[model samples]
Target: MECRFPSVPGAERILSDEALAFVAALHSRFGERRRALLAERDRRQARFDAGERPDFPTDHPGLSDPEWRIASVPDDLKDRRVEITGPAERKMMINAFNSGARVFMADIEDALSPTAENIIRAQINLYDAARRTISYRDPATGKDYALGDKIAVLKVRPRGWHLDEAHLVIDGERVAGAFVDFGLHAFHNAQALIDAGSGPYFYLPKLQHHEEARLWADVFAFTEEWLGLAPGTIKATVLIETLPGAFHAEAILYELRQNIVGLNCGRWDYIFSYIKTHRKDPGAVLPDRAAVTMTVPFMRAYALHVIKVCHRRGAHAIGGMAAQIPVKGDPAANEEAFAKVRADKEREAGDGHDGTWVAHPALVPVAKEVFDRLMPAPNQVDRQREDVVVTQADLLTPCDGPKTMAGVRMNVNVGIGYLAAWLSGRGAVPLHNLMEDAATAEISRTQLWQWRATGTRLDSGETVDAALIDAAFHAEVEALREALGEEAFAVGHYGAAADLMRELVQADELADFLTSVAYERHFAD
Candidate 1:
């Protein structure tokens, strides 16, 4: 018997092809199994999409009473240094802690290998050591006494994404308050932490988008309900270390406002993110390995972005960690490096950042010293009216038409130079063949006010009010126009000038720009 098939040219051609023939043969051999496999994949994907937490086991116990609570540190200890280690690593922790740091985070996440048994043993040792009064003989006096709270913070590794071996074991046990890292995804081990009665608080890492922040909020909300914790108790500190996060910092903070305690600049991950994000661009030729120094532009941008975002949201803007420090053997190099760190801290404090972080215990005293030196006394700059100031000079200078781009270039150069000088605490520095401290106290007020309007945090650790911010905007616009009088007219650059005016009108943009400039100035050296 002969069978007749459809006469469609395209379909017939496909069937005649060798590749199709082989595919058909394979399907005939295992089509049922393939269909079942596809269905299973879809089922798993659907579960994932439906917000089902994956069944990953954790050794950490569920919270007996889950509640949202803010962790507090002593005021004097706020500026102190911290060390990271456990009892097994006690010597290292003691060495670092005694050097100068105010706190110690017994690190089991990045520093230790992912061995379930080992991790459990370390946690037990850490818990036991922290609960008891530790004594160390003072090398100088050869005397033994209880080490004054040898550790301030205890950090635990709660089985990260790739760490599926169940390294974290809780066994229904509770230790005095300790901080845990929820590594990468919030929904992954969140329920476990809550179930074990571990607080809803966590250190969130590698946050890339505002949606991710929102996702964290949602997960916290779910975990709170599931574990019966208070609504706002699930505090989080986002690790802003990606290019997307850098750009959308304001959005992220705005979305996760109440739940976040602060934002931190993760230098190493940020460098890696910068490389990964921009590697495709031929013009951006970056070095093979990111140097530990802060000279890179993107690095500065990331740092400043964190400050701007945190300050805007009334949260702490903790600076990046000064990871490298000179050891005791090299006093001169140590002092120089320490001095540089202090200078950087001073600049951050001056820019109105809340605080900064350092990895080494020895660097803490220097960090605190710099922070203390730079921050202005509370309420030094007062609220003022925008219309009170009058100036004939135009704050905005327009770039000339395409035909005379050179004139536009000159205008840009002059404007930037003036702005730079004004920012450098040298607004009165001589330039253009003239010497004058042209920047007045009013100008200083205007600059600071402009920065404050951006929702930048004040030294008092509060977000600036919108009304005062608006007043500052107008004042800066007037002052900038006065500063650029004839130069604004020379290039016929009214449009550019107007845009600048508009930017100064908005506090957020102004704050971001000012902070970026500050970072560049401090670390660009």
Candidate 2:
């Protein structure tokens, strides 16, 4: 494929003669670099594949053993009356620790300014805060001295690709590390956290491809060897925000399977991605200032995809942030906001999401309440039927009907795509019907696996075989083509999904007809 750069104002254009010469020279240099990188990667992968004594740290020394457990908040805290931090912006970290969240991510990537010096200072303060007890005043009462311990905190640094001169400071000192981008940085940060007597865990952001995820695992292995951390000690929660990442959700999850602890839907970034991906005609895409509602169908699909992916992996599928609440406000307004937050939490819980994040400390109580009500306690398994049950009281209940054989087919096809992508080591692929968009193979496979295990009843069913799945997938693709037209299958500019499907088919690693069906479904346009 020819590389076409996006047209930016004032961008320089090369003359034909200069461009040809430059291309030749660039190719020669790039070929050598690529060869060396690939050779090194292979050498490292060999050691990893052989399960040789890893050079980096693993849970081998019991570093992953929890040294401290934060106290659980009371049910009343769910009323959203608790306040963790002061009103100042800097207080966000302190507030989160006090707000009763099980995990507090000191975000240096997205939430904070992308300046390296500021990031280092923030990290140092956060580290200092984590090691000591802090006090805050009670907002409700005129009381002073409400003591609180630091919660489980994790620091997220900018990815190597995005890091400028600003991301070099760690504890006021320059730390030499490759800034590969979010996926790689996550593993690197996990290693750093583990080395610093903290847990090996992180919240990864801006992930767009399944290959990126596999690369993360590779980097994690490298970090483990470098730092002497245990394998499987570092866990990550990937933020599903961008259009590419959304479609590739299943692939990413599958690649990072055991290492992933949670999956989060990033609503804002996703909205931006959707605008960029779908609005082919620049004029049709809305302006940056447009106010689009978050409740659109695409957003819902993205959210549902995240939830499905996490559930399949038995990992936590965390809901998006509710940043609408005020940090401090009128009592009545605050009460109303808290009430609304409570309702939102109830809805998410009903939808099967394990937990959610809140930007304000004041919102934590309400958030936690919703999670507690929805989540089965660690000790409380099998309290309900194994089927996908939805009481009338549940907010998002499955429609009542005899299971549609067509729906079953769709699920089965989705499963084949999942298995094929996994076998081929792809993160995501286009769905059978939607050539313009893609779904994570992991998500499709998980849904199929769940459906088969649970049965086709409105509430639950049992698992189907690979044969059934393959048949269903092909059928769905055909049905979709008939509905959306052949052109719908044409992903004019999107190559990741098509390329991945092609690789899977060419390799024939999956079931015989699986790749063929996917290719026709995704590329027949």
Candidate 3:
């Protein structure tokens, strides 16, 4: 069959004939199943909306096997005490590798704006990094940026299954964004990565079920066979970021056991998913975004459950991101933020998590220091967390925090600010001194949806409804406009962002992903 690989300007370096064919081959093999799985997601959401609550699947055969364990993890992944995550863009890629973390999660999904240029450029960057030939120079300062003498292990995150690469088409169908990212890297750099003392490692994002994991494992098997490499040449870590993914963590690991190495409690996206999965339940309404910290009951249950399940199955349990960037000029604020990061990492390590994530290079040492003290070894998988028991009630336990009008205003500000930055080609944004990603925006918009749906009362003695939210949103916009000035605000796409934010939060139908909707309307060609 003929393959029609769509062309994007400056994509030629990565889109070699063989690479395009590799992607096309994957599409031909698994595209239909990918579509079917997405359809299943819609069906499951429908059922949930119809009052079916998520419980452990009754028919999963692995649940009955008390003695089964995942395969031993590879050496490179064993000591993931501190990992840094960032976009796959060129400069960010160079900076993260030099961040002194044990692993660098090169993200093409949530942390990146999936513009066609960005996607293709990211592939090229990964290829260069794998070849140890990646370097950059500042256009203005002439400062050279390159790999450090000491570098972190590289783990690339492809776009989630829900995203389609509109720039890449074959047989009159757009290619799955996941396949495009995975295929190019696997084709051009998999062996090169192996030669550099690492393999083609990955962090699978937004998996809703074990079947989706099964599809990825199948892709790995096929790619290995097609490339004449040994089976299991790839290792994957599933981000248990969805409510469904959290419920079936063990089954997910089991499905990809031969090639799966770990599971990360992606806290932000999990919160977003929690709100989204139960948007209809008045009982499921969450408190203010800031109030709903990891120490909250439901989040705590999830963290403990993931650690227990991962340790029981002989895989690594990685912790979530501390998204605070250290303050530049304020020493006291930096100290305070560092203290919070230290405390958070200490808790994760104490709970038997093998590693944790940080968003900025500056915070890497803070996270590393905590793990270094608590974990004398590479990991604490032997801890087993046998005493940690989680029930469905625990997972479903509502957060016990007060909702406030201040939190509402903060959400409106951060959501619109992030969307504006995202629409302007920046994905990882800093708003109110916190490093905000798509997950952060998801929480903001989803909270807006839930608060409006449930008419949640805020601490100010006012019930949250459409009018209240709209007023807050407009107020935040005017405030931003005044702060940013006319020229800056106009260039920031604040108006478009405001429209998009309202559409997402106030729409009759909830969107599964803000990026998925925004990408088609604004970013896609």
Give candidate 2 regions above 4 Å deviation.
Answer: 1-90, 129-147, 153-160, 166-198, 282-294, 327-329, 376-525
Return the TM-score for candidate 2, rounded to 2 decimals: 0.49
Q: Write the per-residue lDDT of candidate 3 for residues 280-383, one digit (tens) a residue.
A: 88888888888888899889999999999888888999999999997989999989988999999999999889999999999999999999999999999889
- The TM-score of predicted model 3 comes to 0.98
What is candidate 3's local distance difference test score? 0.90
Per-model TM-score, in order, reads 0.46, 0.49, 0.98
Model 3 CA deviation exceeding 4 Å by range: 1-10
Per-residue lDDT for 221 in model 1?
62
Positional deviation of residue 301's Cα in model 1 after best superposition, in angstroms: 2.4
lDDT of each: 0.41, 0.44, 0.90
Write model 1 residue lDDT over 396-479, tens digit each, in one string.
111111212222222233334444443432322333322222111112223333333334343345454555444544454455
Cand. 2 Cα-lDDT: 0.44
* Residue clash pairs of candidate 3: none
Question: Using lDDT as the measure, what is the rank order of every candidate, best first?
Answer: 3, 2, 1
